[model samples]
Target: MRGLREWWRDLTDLVLPAECGGCGRGRTVLCPRCRTALSGAAPCRARPVPEPPGLPVVHAAARYADEVRAALLAHKERGVLALTAPLGVALAGAVRAGLREARWGPGDAGAVRARGPVLLVPVPSAPRAVRTRGHDPARRIALAAAGELRRTGTSARVLAVLRQRHAVADQSELGARQRLRNLAGALAVAPGGDRLLCGGGPVVLVDDLMTTGASLTEAARALRAARAGAKSAVYPSSAGEGREERKAGPRMAGPNEGGGVIREAICAAVVAASPDSFEINRN
Candidate 1:
């Protein structure tokens, strides 16, 4: 049934053809030229930008201008589902780099087990936006990144832990400060977030873009809060269980476990970012 559905969609697509998303060339998902532009080196962290307290360190894939911005908007806003694959590839590259940074001091085999798992938690979009887009874009990208990580033998998982606690005004028209204000009380960890973190792993925040980084900051705060709750739950239980606790419980913990230590450890990656679009006076 699914095969037939896909075949029918393909046939329909062929009949009323659309141009390539990356290049606007007739009858293709992406043209060679744009693909060439996109198929460059892996993305890295940009210079630090101030974010809300305890926000994670962020890395972006490409400057959100020219071809990159166009490609991102084309896939995100338009019904360009095919773009997700390549975009996911780009995102996966950043995830790999972030994971490497997180896991760098690791040892092999038994020693590696001491470090625990890596969790990728994506910033949540508004419910209305998800409904209108017909997909959760960040989650979709995170899943792809997780798949990529698993392929490379990293135990990565996606935890959609962040949720909107309040409705935020539209961010498009807001300046940086306005964006931060709009999102001030807008996000919280989902229920069961504590258990999710307690079970195992450090958390990495994921987002599609970072302008003022207000959204990512909120998400990081939520994840850190979850990690703290997770650690507190473990201690008394671990003490109560005594020596037996070591056998059954998760060995490693999330970022907030040690010294209320958030690990400076927070890392993030995106497919693109606003290119010097932020004005100092706009602050």
Candidate 2:
């Protein structure tokens, strides 16, 4: 079934040539210009100006403007799904670097050890956005990343543990602060999924872009809440931090629930950072 689907997709691409994601030229998914532009791997932090609370260190493969942004938009928003392979390769490279940067040892890194599984959790997409796109782009990217990880003799998994409980404003026009505010309570981990997180492995969050990182931060929060619960767990926290359940907010989750200890995270994407707030590492 998968083989046939891929064959059909290849046939379709041959019939309808796609413009180069980088240069917008016809007959290619990525043109020479974009290929050259993204040929190298340079990872840098996509920092927050004010830097929201619990925002872990994030490393991006390239700047998000020009050809990089073009490639990402082309593949992600435009249904240029064929680009997943190239983007996945690029993401895998970034992830490997990020894991190295964090200094995670062999047994420490989830993707390295054969004993435990590595969970790549993607930031959830809003219901409306998913409906309009007919699929979840980030989730698809995560799956591609998992495939890349497995190809290199690593055990990986994509845990779609995030879900939106309510609608929120779109992030296209929002500034960093506004973006943080808009997504503050917009994510949650579903019930009965905590066991997957506590199974003892690394949980890396994957995303297509990192604009201020508000979404990923919230997603990490959900993971933290989930990881806080283990069968033979430590002592419970104080009242405020206790697992006082509530109705699912825009995004709500329980405590002690996590995908295990996230020794490090790698936020990989096809393109560079956006121009407005992106900082490239010239080193």
Candidate 3:
């Protein structure tokens, strides 16, 4: 009888695709209530207690609970493509929030505009995971987020120049320190990636979620390595940064047009984070 009821509902709506990816509400891709939960909140600062080194100033759109958690899981693990837009919208808000707080220092809040279009750099997923999932969720969301930003008059674009240089163990079971150790120097900027960003705008690292933030920290380290035209021996060979990693890297020039480098770490954004992570900003 429950199955029959669902069938009838789908049949009547004529667009009854699937239940809400968020809350399983019948007859809709995403119900209004869950949609609000996912994208309604103003983005806020999120920081992990005992934050790992190299993790940038980070912001998150929603708390990872209730419908927000459900929607992200469905979209990432279950391949619900329809959730990408809404998730992207939420992520864009986080990116904007991060930019708003980054590097103004009592100056104009819009100072980021003076820099150039915003560039979104997504952390690369493992090739094994991408092959298993059949798509790169982070990259897709970054593209969607860039589209949303452009639509709203922000010059934003996705720059997927970072690559996973080594495979990492599953971080789900690891603690903060272990996660950081596992991800150390695991990412590298691709050839010519530095030139792409040399004359470009502010960069924001984008990802689906931030738990320990180990992934984003590694990404920032790689970007910094590329920008400075230096190879970082942040970890020993045990961390998997091999001899090839010692080669000269790309150069991400600063705004000075000559030999300047952006020394400060970049910001990062995510759809949701641990609920407690948001509490740091409540003050």
- Residue 190 accuracy (lDDT) in model 1: 80
Q: Write the residue-wise lDDT of candidate 2 on 1-283 in tens digits.
A: 9999999989977766557877788788777677666647555556646566676556566767688777887776787887776677666655655455554323355545733666777787888888888778788877888898789866778888888867899898998789888888778778766677666455667787777778877877777766665432643442443232322211211122233232333332322444433433332
Q: Which numbered prediction scores highest in lDDT against the true structure?
A: 3
Query: What's the true lDDT of residue 132 in model 2?
Result: 82
Report, for every candidate in turn, its global Cα lDDT versus the true structure: 0.67, 0.65, 0.81
Q: Report the lDDT tens digits of candidate 3 across residue range 1-283.
A: 9999988877865544468988897767789899889888888888887787667888899999999999998888888888899999999999988776654311343655676788999988899889988889999999999999989878889999999887889888999999889988789999889766665778899999998888998999988778656322222343543444334322223332244233353778999998988778767
Which segments of candidate 3 are over 4 A away from where they belong? 1-16, 103-114, 230-265
Cα lDDT tens digits for candidate 1, 174-238: 87778888888788888888687656565678877777778887776666567667776667454
As for lDDT, the candidate ahead, 2 or 3, is 3
TM-score of each: 0.77, 0.76, 0.81
Model 1, position 24, has a per-residue lDDT of 73
> On a 0 to 100 scale, what is the lDDT of residue 221 in model 1?
66
Clashes of 1: 0
What ranking of all candidate models by TM-score puts the best one first?
3, 1, 2
